[model samples]
Target: MARILLRSGKSPFDPVSPQQVIQQNLIATNTGNLLFGDAVHKMLLTPGTEITPNRYQVDPADADRINDEYDVFVVPLANAFRPSFKRHLNDLSALIERLRIPVVVFGVGGQAGTDYGTDHLAPIEQEVRRFCSAVLERSPSIGVRGEFTEKYLNGLGYSEVDVIGCPSMFMHGRELRVDKRAASLEDTAGLAVNVSYDSGNIPGSVIGNGLINRLADAALERYSDLVYVAQELKDMELLYWGDVSEAAGTSSPAPLTRSHPLLREDRTRLFHDSSTWIDALRERDFAFGTRIHGNVAALLAGTPAVVLCHDSRTLELCRYFDIPHRLVADLADETDLAGLPAQLYEEADFSAMVDGHGERFDRLVSFMDRHGLDHVHKPGGDDGAAFESELETVDLHPGMSSWKGGHDGGLGYRLAWLREADTRSRVRQSASDKRVRELTSRVGSLERQIEESAVLAKELAKANKRLEQLVKEVRSSPYRRLRRFAGRLVRRVRSRS
Candidate 1:
């Protein structure tokens, strides 16, 4: 069996975060980790392949161990080619340099605003080159997200690039069906909305933060049953830990603050896993947002989605997949928000999108095949079906909430709250112990370095002493005195002449 390693943002087996286990439950429910990591794992797993998940931020020292363990290293990166991602990309390049096995990249892309301009990416051109070069040395080609990324690489003189979109789109292979269940969105309909403060507005751009803010505010007002989904750690912190007095003065995103309608009205949510997120979206009427994955989650849930693309990262994927989207630049010019959702669907061709999925799926398969990967969707294969079954057996994460008790209220809530207190105490203690272990390990490494430095210092001291002794001997030697006397005699003879 071939051993494959997956590099991603999160792992399926990561410790249950405080966000995931907000209340005591029979089992800690966390599906957030599965959003990208496990979904890719399922897609890549074949009958003869064994897979392991590792976080993107790898310790350089572990490279040798990884080289010995895995046959191929695969990275599934979403919007990883941005300026913010340069450092991590460089780190991945360093990690790639240490690997002896083949490295295959999946759906990596560059970022600019929805205009697809390359100006913002200029600073990282050399960085991208280094990363691509390292991967090319280990594999035949690098898989890019879409046309913009492919062009981005071509401009850098890298021709061995394939446009495979994203693996997440193939969670169910070519059987994807994203339909607008309701012909029109209504005020009473259940709406799933996602927003972000960071990417919504770029400095010097007229169409960023304000557009998303207006859309969010309009949606909240129009729909009575609405849920706002947040994806980033800061947003998670704001949602769960924002009530503290210290939090008031801290830098929480304005839209996520206690004064914001989403959190203030008890309509905000953060999921620990993809399954739960997708499941939640599956029950909603429509999803629209600045978040690519958030809208993707909605599509995967069989709901219609409208992606508000402020940048190339979201724009490229939405375009490639035929998902409906409006450039934030264009949306900023619109005055009426009441009919935007319906208008977006009317402009989008869902049938065409679904029709072309097979070809795209084949393209993804071809990219995998070129790198010698065995996917679950091969001819006469039940690998894909088997993966779905395996995912079902995985435990679910708890729902999102800050309360000690589960979402349920009353005496049952009190009992759950007591249990939650105990769990939290234990969780804190475990975290403390883990920190101590990490510190001890670091200290041990430092001690060894110090010992090595000490030995080198002693050796340098001995060498210096030997040099001093040699100088002293030369100064006292008979040859040295004779030469000095001869020089003086020559000088006196010259002066007499």
Candidate 2:
């Protein structure tokens, strides 16, 4: 059996508590990463192939172990070409350089403005070059998200780049079907809304113009079964802890805070795993969001979803997958915020995305084949039955909700987690305090040594000054003068002889 090492926070089938997921950042800071990671894991679960999640490690020292244990290293990334991700990209590149096994990268993307300009990516160009070079050394080609990233890498002189969209869209192995159950939005039974809170600060983002939040607010007022799906870690903290510290650096807007109507009314949910997220979305009538994977989760669940394109990454993927979408900037002129969700839902058409999915899936599979990797979607493969069966047996936790609203067993579980977390925090704090005291004592000892050294230095300086004075006085003494006169007289007599 061939062993494959996959880069992911945790396996999709791993049932972890929400607290552990948050503390360890198993979602990799954003829950969206898990969607594609889960997709890649399931897709690569072909017979005779054993897959293991690497826990997102990229240590170069682990290269030897990985090469000895695994036949290949598979990385499924998102917007890793941006500046903020350069350090991680470089680390991964360093690890790949030392590895003797094939390394395959899938759906890596470069983030930029909505105009699809590559200028913003100039800072990370060299990092991108080194990373792609390392991957190409071990594989036939590198897979990218869309046209912009493809063009960006092509301009960087890499010709072996392929546009494979994202693995999350191909999770069902080339078969995708999305049907609109409601003729109009008002007739819909449930609505799932997602938004990128930080996008409100970006220049041309949908949230900046208030379309996403306005629509979410409208949905909150209209739909009783509305769910505001949050993707960021801080949002998850707020949902689970009920209050995120100001130190978390989350910006203003009550909607993102604990006081938001959605959070306050227990309408917000944060999923620690992708399967639960998808399962929840499956029950929704429609899902719309600025978050690509949030809507992708909806699509994966066969729920109709439309992406509100805010930036290049989201726009390109939506275009590549033929996912239904609308530019937030295009709706800036509209004043009727309450009716916009209905209008967007009524206008969305998923025919092309569904019909063309097989071609995209085949493209991804071909990319894998070219790189000497096998996938479940290939001929004679199980098509993810084993992966699905194992996933079904795992008792994965549900989406995390506020503790203030529910009286169910989930609430009890959350309370127990909180109590345990609090106990752990106190123990850690106690250990930290002990360490601090030890450091303080060590610092005091160092300060006393410094004071003693200062005193010795002062005494040495004084002794040196006294020695100089004694030598000067001795040299100026009468006996010294007489000896110098005798020496000169002897030298004069010798010269005369």
Candidate 3:
């Protein structure tokens, strides 16, 4: 077993809560790094080894637990590997530099597509060079995910960079079985639209508006049923808000699917494994996905799929596997799918693409062996098996995958209705604002009139009481005549004075 260091340059805590974030970071110190990087770790790291005794902390002191125990280090990252995190990447760079250990990257993605210069990524690009340059300086080979990533590294003047594609898509050597007369459910066609919150820097309105919907309709034309799948928990919230907000007042049939144990408990719901949703996708004829893993699920199940391309990660994987896809800009209009279902491709025809990916995998393997650590995939590769066991520790129990609504899956017409409702809501809000101002003025005037009337009533009551007392005095006196005399004497006394 090769003692190793696995890396993901993210803080393990929620960004919203400082306390929770602190707790998450603390947990990472105990664990070292996660068992595997998001996509590639599973590819070469094998299934049965502990990557590192301690993980997840950038502070070298916390990571020092394995200063001597580990033989090699594998850093798995996404597109751009900068210190966008709290100095985590820099710290990892320092560790590699000091130990003089071999470091290999597994299909790391995340550079803002190759279209823009590294200058756009700013300080992040600088920091990436700082870390990567040190590793390359030590003679460890580096691998990247796509053309964009490879270009970014080359721009850095690093010579040994290789384009490995994403570990998520293995050039599965097996041929794909395509059902040509693949009939959807009776009377209608079935279309699967996978929703994601992390649009890879995509705008919310883009997903909410006609862009993603147009593709959904294309898939729906040939099917009677359409459904949306969510891989992460937050994705569930996005599907409704993104789709419902757009579909309001509209008769859109965009209902959410539920898994078992629908408790509002903590992180349990969101952490449900990808397997739950993958099994669910097998029931559908075709799936259209924006999330990388969503498409991965489709291929894993041998289902025909189309990548609605957005950013570099999606584009890189789709092209590498020779799968069919469309970009966001292109898919905005119905014209995007000019040939209709012709753009969809079977996952079986990707052997060349898979073979192309082998060089990157080889680099990952080479990095491990260079450090004297044997991955479990190799002849004596115990590390790979142990790595898998670690994943087993994570409960992939996704709550209820099946919830309500089997009959009315088509909500396309309903989405149109929702658009009308949203317009009405805006109109209502304007009307309500005007009504509030009018009613507020009326209330103010009424309050002042009531206050003035109260004062007049108080004065009237005082005068009435005085009159009653005088009448009582006069009436009780046998002395009405005496009162008159007293009044005259008072007048006389005034005149004499």
Candidate 4:
């Protein structure tokens, strides 16, 4: 089996409790639980955690267990190790620094929090540059998700970045098609907002009351239902919507997928089960959301979508893939969701948009070119030095080609990948949840003990009352007189005897 080190921040199977969802953003519904390294043969995850953030996807404890005997080591990045997972980022960067093997990244997200002209993403820009240096130092080139990422990296002096977009977006195919629609398709609007409380106040993902008010005003013009899509399971978009619904007293509310987690699952179950989302959105007239892959999924199902740009990732993907989208900031006070949806929903030629990606696609070609890599490669070619040299890094690559299109060694080895990554991340999370419950339960027990102390307090109060009564009686009564009489009686009796 191929051993791969993947980068995933949030566990997929993490509990999607309302409070928990509002508290964390671990599960990106579209990206699900994993990141780049799908090309790796016999893929095994060395997951990263806080203790060893460097090995968030691929734990350091599994280092020796996975370091050798595997074909290649894969390193992935979401937002290129932004401070969101700082310690983990350091660990990952350090691991890449010392990695003896070659690795290639697929659809890696880069951090462009700030522009280079100013101090915007300056500190993180350094970390990103450091990450890029390490990756390019080891692997030939690092594949970034989009143009903005590329621009940010290039600004930091990174040269060999490929704009591969998100692996989840490429999942359907190279191109996107805008589905046909009927006239006046009102009451079919979908708005996918990312309400993640886990991430520090992300303004980009929020559709607060004010925003909702604006959307509602817009809806009055033409829209019907406003669907809230969750980028991560911990997203609070549903909660926001729930509050909105309760306030409005609406009988129908938004749908929620709280069960998704960060663990690896069987492919059939993973892909197929995830497809139900399309069925859910089938009747919707149109959709727009902050989750990049959420829109991609809609587009994949031939449903038209508009992406609400949250960060560089969203903007980069839309720009790279030639998808129809608009910046969230671009929406003004006059901008209403209910007004006539743009040409993007209809007659916005996807082919033209894709062709419009001329500059962006060139970046991808440039990345592969710089790395001396190709989309597909077969082993045993002497001239294929780039693939061969990189092949030693990852077990699976485009290098291991078969007539059946991944039917032989790559596909045949699927069972091995499954066996290795068959890691029960859910169980781990559940055990963790159980431990949390146990701790909370202990707190409950202590509270009960404190309550029982009230009974003991009542008994003590009764004893105090009895002692007071005795003291009062001794003080008020002629105890001295009674004692004198008793003494006289005893003396007289003795004299008479």
Candidate 5:
């Protein structure tokens, strides 16, 4: 059996607690990452192929082990060409430089504003080049998220790039069916809403004028059964611990504060695993949000969703997949904000996305074939039956809800919270002690430096005094005066001659 190493925090079947997921950041900072990772993992489970999650490790020292143990290294990424991910890109590049196995990247994208400009990406241009160059050397081509990333890489003088949307959309193989169950959104029973808090904070952003948050607020007020699906680590922290302390000082009208209805009413939830996330969304009538994966999770659950494209990353992916979306910039100018959800639900067209999925899946499989990687969707592979059967046997955790929510205030829940809180407090104290020790060591080094400087100053002072005494002695010598007077006499004789 061929061994495939995947870049993921953990296997999808591995059930981790909310506290450990938060503490270790097993989702790699955003639970959204697991969506694509899990999709790729399921896709690559062909016969005679065994896959293992790498736990997000990119250590160059482990290159030899990987080379000997694994036949291929597959990476599924999201907006990795941004400035914030440059260091990680460089680290991955360094590790890839030493690997002898094939390396393939799936649905990697470049993040920019809604204008799709690459001027802001100049800072990490070299890092991007190095990462792409390393991957291409080991593989036939690199799969990009959409048109913008394809253009960005082509502009950088690379031709070995393909637009494959995202692996998450192809999780169910070639067929994706999304039908509007309710005749209208208002007639729907439940609504799932997701938001990107930072979307409202970015300067010059199309969605920066509180447009995304306002839409979320409208949905919250209009639908009594609305559930806020959060994807960020901080949101998970808030849902698990009910600690709105991070939102304490923020005065922004956006959901940055606990005063928001979601937190106050315990209407927010964060999923530790993607299966549970999709399973929970299965009960919702429709999902709409700025978070791409959040809506993708809804679609995976066979529920219709519309992506609110706030930037180039979301816009490009939605366009590639033919996923229904609306530009937040355009929505900001509309006067009727309350009726926007109904309009979006009515306008969304899922036909093209569903119709073109087979071709896209074929393209993705072709890309994998060119790189010598096998997938479960290929001929003679069982179409992920084994992966599906394995998933069915694992008992995954449910979505994390607020501590104050219904049935969550029970004694068992409170005990778990207390234990987790105590563990967190101990971690904080340990961190504090570590910081104090560091400061004490720094202070000791500074004192030693000061003492050395003082000793050096005294030595210099003694040397200066000795030099002054020697100079005074030389001036006071009579033989020295006679030599000077003779020299003056010789000069007067020469002038006369």
Candidate 6:
């Protein structure tokens, strides 16, 4: 058996949130981290293979252990090539260079706005080069998300690059089908929407944040069952912790927050795992979101999805996979909220997208095979039947909700973990101190005994030395030699008799 190590952002064993999730909110609250990680893990699922828990963050300190523990390392990244992530890319590059085993990258892409410009990554060109070169050294070619990344890497003088889209999209492998139960938007339609309000760099883009919030507002008001999906930790924080006042801040678009009327009314939910996220979307009539993974989750669930592309990172993937999407700016001219979701659903056809998936899936498998990875879905085999069967047997984790109003599953979650850790530390410290005092008393007693023993040993040595001198003096006497000679002569006469 071979172990395929998954290098991801968060460990799959991340503590189940202590917060009790409303049963209705369970599917909506799954974090994208879990969603992405789960997809990659399941994608590589094969007989006689093992996958390690995510080794979060690339630290040079863990390189040796990683190489020794796993045979192959697979990285499924999203928009990893950006100035903001340059430092991380450098660190990962250094770590990759240290890895003696093969490293396969899937869906790694450069980030920019909708312009698809490469200028943003200029500062991190060397970092990207080093990272790509390191992966190419271990694998046949670097699998990229789309043409933009292909061009980006080619410009950097990397020839071994293939546009493999994203592994997350192929969570179910080749076969994908989404049915529109409703021809038009109905009040009873199960609508799922996601927004990416956490793109801090483009903080001021009205279309990026404001338009999605507007669409969400309209959908929530008109639809009976609408789920607003948030893909960032901050959005999750606001959903669970931020009070109405903080959510009402000018900086916050309340429509996407817990303060939203629908969210407050218990029509909103958050998801922490992909299984629930995908299952939740499976029940939805339509899912449209600014978050690429948000829509990708819908696609994986076989639900029709529309991506509100605000940047190049999303644009390229949508284009590559033919995922139905519209620019966020287009929503500005739209007036009717009730029909907008239906309109987008009708206009966006996923047949070509779904039809082309088989080839793309094969491309992914070929890439994996070239890197010596045996995937569950063989090229000409029964698509993803084996993968799905294996997935069904997985005892998946349940999604978590916020404990209260502050845990964003990042700092707040970590803070809660830290508090628990501190408490444990105090308890351990108390026990350790008690043990230390007991050991100290025993050591003192041992030291005292050693001192006493040393004195006795010294006295015994002096006595022995005197006894040795006395024996030497007695032996030196001529009388002692005459007695010994007489004893020997008597013994010889006795033996002769």
How accurate locally, in lDDT, is each candidate?
0.75, 0.84, 0.52, 0.48, 0.85, 0.73
- Candidate ranking under lDDT, highest first, comes to 5, 2, 1, 6, 3, 4
TM-score of each candidate structure, all chains considered together:
0.76, 0.80, 0.57, 0.54, 0.81, 0.73
Q: Candidate 1, residues 62-108: lDDT per residue as tens digits?
A: 89999999999988776777787778788888899898999999888
lDDT of model 4 at residue 328? 50
Q: How far is candidate 4 from the true structure (C-alpha RMSD, Å)?
A: 16.6
Quantify how close model 6 is to the true structure by its C-alpha RMSD in Å. 17.5
Summarize candidate 3's per-residue lDDT along 1-497 as a digit string, tens digits: 55566665232221222233233442232111221243334444554444542335556554355456765566665544533452767787767667645666666665443133345456676677877787677555676766766777787777777666655454221223334235323324444566543344433224445455445445544444655554443333322223333223333332332121111111112222333445565665676667566666666556667676666666776675566676665555557442344455433244553354455456545644664544454665553344445555654434333222236564533553464478579899999999999999999999999999999899999999999998988877868878888999999999999
Model 5, C-alpha of 167: deviation from truth (Å): 0.4
| Model 3 weakest 10-residue run by lDDT | 260-269
lDDT for each residue of candidate 6 in 1-497, tens digit (9 for 90 to 100):
98888865433334345243322232223356566666777767666777875545568888899888999988877778988878878888888899999888888888776776666567788888889888888888988889989988888899999898878887777677877776676778888887776553633234544666677777777888887766655455555554433223433455444445655566656666676678878888889878888888888888889998887778898998899989876667888866788889879888889888888888887887777777767655455466566556665544433334334546644554455467579999999999999999999999999999999999999999999999999998999999999999999999999
User: In candidate 5, what residue range of length 10 has the lowest lDDT sum?
Assistant: 243-252
Instruction: Give the candidates in order of TM-score, highest first.
Output: 5, 2, 1, 6, 3, 4
Question: Residue-pair clashes per candidate, as listed?
Answer: 10, 0, 54, 33, 0, 11
RMSD of each: 8.1, 7.6, 18.9, 16.6, 5.5, 17.5
Clash list (residue pairs), candidate 2: none
Candidate 3's displacement at residue 123, Å, is 4.0
Name the weakest run of 10 consecutive residues (lDDT summed) in model 2: 243-252
Question: How well is each residue in 167-241 modelled by candidate 4, as lDDT tens digits?
Answer: 554332234455657643445544323222222323343333344334433543354345444444323332222
Per-residue lDDT of 249-337 in model 2, one digit per residue for the tens?
44445366655778767788889888889889989999887899999999999999999898889999999988889888887887877
Candidate 1: residue 212 Cα off by (Å): 1.2
Q: Candidate 1: list runs displaced more than 4 Å.
A: 9-15, 19-34, 200-207, 244-253, 402-497
